[model samples]
Target chain A: MIQKEYEKNEKTVTVSVVNFNPVWGDKAANLQKIKTMVISASQEGSNIIAFPELALSGYECGDEARRDHKPCSMHEEAAETIPGSSTAEVAKLTKELGVYVLFGIPERDEKNPKVRYISVAVIGPEGILGSYRKIHLAPPPTFTEEACFKPGNDLPVFETKYGRIGVQICADFWVYPELSRILCLKGARLIINCAACMVGQTGPEFIAQITGCRGTENFIYAASASLAGKERTLSYYGRSTIAGRAFPSFKQIFAQGGDREEIVSATLSLEKGQPPFDQLSLEKERIRSFELCANELKKLAESR
Target chain B: MIQKEYEKNEKTVTVSVVNFNPVWGDKAANLQKIKTMVISASQEGSNIIAFPELALSGYECGDEARRDHKPCSMHEEAAETIPGSSTAEVAKLTKELGVYVLFGIPERDEKNPKVRYISVAVIGPEGILGSYRKIHLAPPPTFTEEACFKPGNDLPVFETKYGRIGVQICADFWVYPELSRILCLKGARLIINCAACMVGQTGPEFIAQITGCRGTENFIYAASASLAGKERTLSYYGRSTIAGRAFPSFKQIFAQGGDREEIVSATLSLEKGQPPFDQLSLEKERIRSFELCANELKKLAESR
Candidate 1:
């Protein structure tokens, strides 16, 4: 196993993105798959590894093809509570490998087990750091994401050895640019997105374009992990990627191509005042920009 | 000239993006070049045409190579007032061809001619509709945009026979995505971006990515015209492009390659409720998303 030591105050961390296909409603099988992938990524010297959305139980939501889509009630059977058995299992692996892992799961509400959220958990060497519920659910008529999961409310930025980081679910990150902006404003230097995205008319190219824009616009490092292969109702596009902000110049340093079930890794130097990021005062500029459009945006919200 | 008839109720408008080299500090020569390009674009059946930032005087800012960068004071000599001789000349052409045009210029203040703004003007057949000043200035250490021109204040959306439109100058569009979001929310079906961007490590690919995002995110058509060829201090990547928003599936209907001087046109069907654009409650969703990040965004602004 390769274990590269980080220099003092340098704050360099290796991140890995895993693209794997999960069998729908198969929690046991998916957990096993994640265990193997996490160990392998850790062995490859990755300090952090991310899995696709609903990785634990697979993306069982119905798409256009499945007319008589199974209701959210059916999928609730696969939901697990945070720090439950599945997280416990991953926690053991994180402890052994000394690596941080972020993976998606169908989360059951503590007070109401019937309520579920498409959620992602952050696991560190010590234990579960935190979790993010998927906000900005997928639009209806085509897919039934709103029918299956309850939306997340809070935007959380977790403290890590490398830097302050944030998590966003697939559609939440794809639907609009606000989630990323909020996370970055909350002091997130890097954002992790977990998705089980399907290939649409534009194909995987659309996702790739969105990923690049998210990183560039927010001036933050972004690591996105997506699923590959066919599931029950839809086929997933496997193009997990990680992009970093290049300094002195405003261009994105993106990881090349990987459109299949594979692990992609890149090292990030957590130094201050880099290009793109340093070019503008992040929070200040975002606030000003947001303020400029505050009235219009408010009107837009009311109309919706 | 090729004048394709528009179908009843179908708002299909053709847009042209021009990519050309501008002669630094030469208003007359640049104006002549624009006249030729506009006629050519009109002949090709384009109802609207867009030119690069500072196309009238070229991007004459200093880079590392240019040891003695000219002051914005020197360039102010080239600045002209709106509806001045140059815009008047373009207005005559627009009236003759029955086409709407947008192009970059160093704008002189009417009250204080000494005050200049990095601006782009929108001209219809009748006369000048309005203009947008560069709101987000380039960082001084890299480009001396701040020292040269005063920033613009208001965001104006123009109503035309084609549709509602908005304009943003180079760095303004590149810096803050809020400008595009606000314009789209304010009923701008199409946004015009005029840029005199320099070639960077990512080359034309970076600009292409940003263009796609600006269009897709707002669910609006976006056309970006950038300067091509070499200037005194920097070499520009002339990859002017016009991207259409595909309905039902948020895929960006992008126009092909642009690394030379040419007019690329695409037909936009003014159909309501298309993929992507038609998918969600745009204004409402934007309002909610903006509200979700309002406090955080405000904090960011205050921090700045």
Candidate 2:
């Protein structure tokens, strides 16, 4: 694994994600907002671009989603299946402009009749790749996700000309280490978290650090895009972030545009992965010896 | 756990540990030194006190331990069993004096016949309650722990009037989630780590922070004592530190004196435990949730 250190700089992929605070019941306004973002990301040379959860329908579709979580409702007639209308339009742009795209949409699960809510990522490389549904719904008492959404079971990691990738919808990243760790074990070094990060939080720094901490722990690169701006039922914090283990600290590449919402981009490298363990880098292996010592103590305690 | 809420002040336990920079062949000098420190901890009102690993024999016995890893040889005749001579000596002052003591010793495993280096804690309700051995060993190429030690296996927690306590020998804490988490799970609130943390050939602040970082991860109180003074082999930074999950930041209650040696003490309240995870006061929960949201992005990178 210790390949002779290369003299050249590590090659990186520049990816952009939009953190647009979508307006509830305002499909045209949100579409215009997303269009501007997609255009900016394209101009910025982002090979691939993504948006927050429910970016197309907006996160505040609370009761509206319960009525009929369909894209065709409320003027979003263009929002259809992964390969239906939305992908068709975005795919046409991909061929025209030669840029990859993944975004959020009101997903209808073909497998289960009862499951329906916000599904994300209209994957496309040349045309359309596939879809990823939001898993681990935040039920009532926490949020109303369980009532409106079916928890996605399949965790898919994407591989394009760019890099190995994994995608997840909001709140799926909480304590379910298996979701992302499985992707890492599957050799997917890049995991994208599509989040509608809520507004009015505390310790932006610590919240931001989790990306880097997990990256260091699991040995991978992770990027998260969150919804930015205030909607009706919820206000989205557009402070999206990305982290790689190589860096000492996680960098916040995207800040919710103070006023004008914009796309944020950063280059993630694959070469500088660090072994999370092997913490014993010094001359004195205290933790190792302590283990022996603790074992002795445990035996004594049990006997007593 | 919410009992700490109504209290006017927080109860903190400061377990003082003595660090030894042992002379390669000088066990008598080291034992005499420990005798003095034990007497001082009781005088200073330290509710509990500890010593570094293999404090009596000095950590640099090397091949001499191959012959006999005892405290005394020939004229001196030192090494003793768990409740043997040294334990009796240590308990004499502690039993009546109202201080709990944990010190390192060379344990003779009667069962295996193979003499392994043991880190034992001779705790006293007012004296020696029991003992613990060093479970995890620090072997070669990794560090210098393999020079004269064998590993121990087992995890144990001790119960006393002070609290249900768990003991970890230096390196053991790093490997055994079962050691730390299980202790916490099984109701051991206080975790005492005894190590003769030698001042290796590295910067002191860097090592201190590394130790602090480990303490922060496993949410429990940690009182570590390292050998102090320039005892020939290595320099003991003498900065004996004590900390817990609540106080992630390492606080040195006592440090080694410049030329001579001294004992430091702090009164710790066994009652001042953190609030239960479920009833995590509003302000605390907000920080936790905010951190949860931020770390959510990192979720997909690493797996359990």
Candidate 3:
């Protein structure tokens, strides 16, 4: 794993985004790859490290015809519980390294064996914090997330020693701006997106643009870790990025990985003057719009 | 005026975005400039033409100190009614040329002369169409819109011969994604943003990025026209753009303008196969999320 760092100062938090390809349906190999990266990142002094969406089980789960013909699909077989074996192993590593880790996995419902969710598991030193299921599933015609997985209902923000962090899956971050806004209102200083962004879906540049806007609009740090390389018919382009307010004013890409396998890191100062956490003034200013937006939203809902 | 056009077919609508510096608070000169551009654009076969926000009186309304000291500030003095002399003249031009025009001006409230709005007036061949008032006012610390103008409460979609069009001012377009989504839900085929986007507020590239996202997310044509050159302490970068889905799939920038004074035009195919008007399938797909988004928004509002 290659390591790079931004200039660090007092009251700073360093984040690392891992961009790698997972062997399709190979949980053991993927878990080992993730552990190695976690250890390396922890040794490099990263407070938080994030892996791409569906990194544990890979993205594709066989063709539609085959899945329909078979009694149990590859995704169903690979799906595990939130605090299942994979997360338990990662939690132990996080506990030993004293660093937080976030990665996506197929989550099997505890009550119903048939139900599954495309979720990102947040593992901290204390153990598994929680998982944020994919809220906005990729729609039909081109993408097929909605066919296999059920959409998530809640938007949860996890508390960490470094700061409050909110997680979003690929479509949740790319398609819906409301999710990020709600997360920001709930006091999330950082928004992390775990994505299995494919080349055919949208341009890599457009993804970075949306990621940067999420940060600029909320005045918070936004990071996206995406899967790379080809698997089955899909080709994932891993242009992972961490975007937020740079020193004085303008929002920019703090650190970015390439379209190939790589790890990008950036050290951000959370002090008052150093932005993405200018909470007091900016939030007060934005509060005026919240009521207006909420009222409009309510009206739209009532009409619908 | 430099004119450039994308290849047009049988069912296509051409749009022109004007990037020009208004003579600060000079109604006569600004109106004359607008008329000249409209006539030029109409001759170039543009079905619709849009100008920057506060194009009549310019963006800055003196300074905070001057505004506090004077009984009638420059903005108040310059404010006019929706169907006032400016729109009347523009309507005459549009009627003569057979085209639709959208441009910003200081709108004086019918009942209270002291109350003003940063609004975009829509004028067509028939006469004066209604104006859309700036909903989300730019807050303090930097912007002075809230201090001088009353926020508009409604989101109106105007029906035109070409399509249904929605208008948004600078802060409304940049800050709130909800407004655009609501407009899209209300059956707006195109969203036009009139902005006096200053350099210090955000990068020009960032503005284009957000503009593209607005189009890509909603699956509709999104266009932005902004003021060019300097006005007192503020330096406005034009960079107006028209973004939407290209031929088969990808969302891309169809047309764009530069930092200096210029006029950009694009001929967009609005046919069934051609996108930004793929209305049937895309709209049906997005309806599922609308109810969910609306419900979440209501919850947020109630909590607030």
Candidate 4:
């Protein structure tokens, strides 16, 4: 396996987010585009490169199938298994480039071929690292994921050479704050959101707002890669962002993409030392309050 | 009790937030200032008015005693019982004005005199409606609440003439997102944050960022009333704000105060109809995910 040499002098990782626009339901074409972007980003010295949610099959592929009154939706028709063709292709590319890559796909369950999930696969030079299925499926009149996709149960953090990283899909990052907090408590130093934010329904500003808060509140680095351009009736607002604290108390938007296809990268320092006195105290208090918060959440779940 | 007549012509309720400056450890003088503001706000036709956290006894009263190396801190010396003199005074003012009022105080536990909590009291025309003791305490190095204050155990929602309202203190609203979620689930339409945001440690923008998220995410109205001006060595950044969705998908800052003493008010319509299809689906998904989220939180707390 070919491994790219990272600088041993500095504890920094350069992460890149690709604001991609995929041809609807065209897996082969999308994979070729992804391969080119991944190589370009790798050549740019990015340790980790990420793509938008459903970058392989496009976000509105299922909607098109549903609208056409097809017996099987495009999501089912185009769904790939974890170690299947698409992932193996990306895995091969990563092995050659010697960089970690993350991109979204519709994963077909091996046993139950009918069941599918909105998932992001993380691949390293060694091969398929892991995949995080989108847990919070977007529901209802605006966008319908629940009609076709099943929600994932576990919140898993992937071990990486850069750091322990956690991946979350679009709505999961925007709506639920607890998911990120849980990821933070589980030792995720950097969180990546694979998103496909639609225009009108949810804008880029809202994405930046919640994304920045998640980063600052948990005191962790966060990056989001989004799908730009249009997919059938849905037009995506791609303002992919990387947010972290520049100073200890202030959150800074390190890099942000515009409405068009582009790449945004930021080098984040992973050095650890004793936290400032205020931060230490705040962290201690956060841990202390977790039990109470957990109990309340349990009660809320039970009541529901 | 003289009840203020509310207009039944419309479904709107005017809520006021007082950006206050309190004299350190001077409860009597502060109460007088509060009374004056309450009357002024009531005259301006506000159904509810809120004051900053620890408005009565001042935010840095304990720090003063700590600095002086006194045996008993001002927080201990000046702490009042919930049904104590202060609540009675506020009750009288609210009863006369026939309006609802919320203000923070250091509550001395009736059972245990040594125990004190950073708490907000909600008083109505009838009397002292209820009080929400701050569940999350600010820890050391920035500001020390854990040094003298005990964290509250309960998250309570009080029913008022306008609607059901919930109260949270400074750190509780800023740090813990689940606390507001629990309150929202328990039927709180309006969440009020009583805050003492310090100048250097936390600023106005950070307060606004989290406050807006809490409102927009829950699809509920949120307001923060904060302590302004200086308190000994600490200076408070007072950008008190009220936030809610102006449009269905857009969260708007309805009203915001400056860095000095002021009262900001906004009229919100509380008419409940069937939620939009998008909102309905989102709420359904949120409820469905609660079980999985609670389990994760439980595991996280256990790991610690």
What is every candidate's C-alpha DockQ against the true complex, given to 2 decimals?
Answer: 0.47, 0.08, 0.32, 0.39
Measured with C-alpha atoms, the lDDT of residue A206 in candidate 4 is 71
Native contacts retained, all candidates in order: 0.46, 0.01, 0.23, 0.31
Interface RMSD of each: 2.7, 11.3, 3.9, 2.6
What are the C-alpha RMSDs, in order, of all predicted structures?
4.7, 9.6, 5.4, 4.8
Q: Which portions of model 2 show Cα errors greater than 4 Å?
A: A1-10, A15-19, A25-32, A47-50, A60-84, A87-106, A117-135, A168-171, A196-202, A236-238, A247-264, A272-304, B1-304
Per-residue C-alpha lDDT of model 3 across residues A1-304, encoded as one tens digit per residue: 0001111323678999988799888899999999999999988989899998889988875677234532237688889999899999999999999889999999998899788999999999888999999877654445556667887878888978766789999877876776677677667778999998778667777667777878876677899998988876788879889997664445788888888888888998765454323322544444445555556556655776
Give the Cα-based TM-score of candidate 2 against the true structure.
0.57
lDDT of 1 by residue, A126-150 (tens): 7998799987776666667777778
Per residue, candidate 1 scores C-alpha lDDT tens digits across B1-304 of 0012112233678988788788887889999999999998899898999998888988775342124443554466788889788999999999999999999888899999878888888899878987788777765556677667777767888878876788988756765777777787677878888987677733577777778778877767888888888876678888787775685456564674467777777887775546543456665667677677776666655765
Q: Model 1 lDDT vs. the true structure? A: 0.76
Evaluate candidate 1 and give its CAPRI docking class based on DockQ: acceptable
DockQ winner, 1 or 2: 1
lDDT of each: 0.76, 0.55, 0.78, 0.79
TM-score, each model?
0.91, 0.57, 0.90, 0.90
TM-score, cand. 3 vs. native: 0.90
Q: What is the lDDT of residue B73 in candidate 3?
A: 76
Once model 3 is optimally superposed onto the true structure by TM-score, how far is the C-alpha of residue A169 displaced, in angstroms?
Answer: 0.9
Residue-wise lDDT of candidate 4 within A7-49, one digit each (tens)?
2323788999988988998889999999999889888899889
Model 1 chain B scores worst on lDDT over the 10 consecutive residues at B1-10
Best by TM-score: 1
Model 3 Cα interface RMS deviation (Å): 3.9
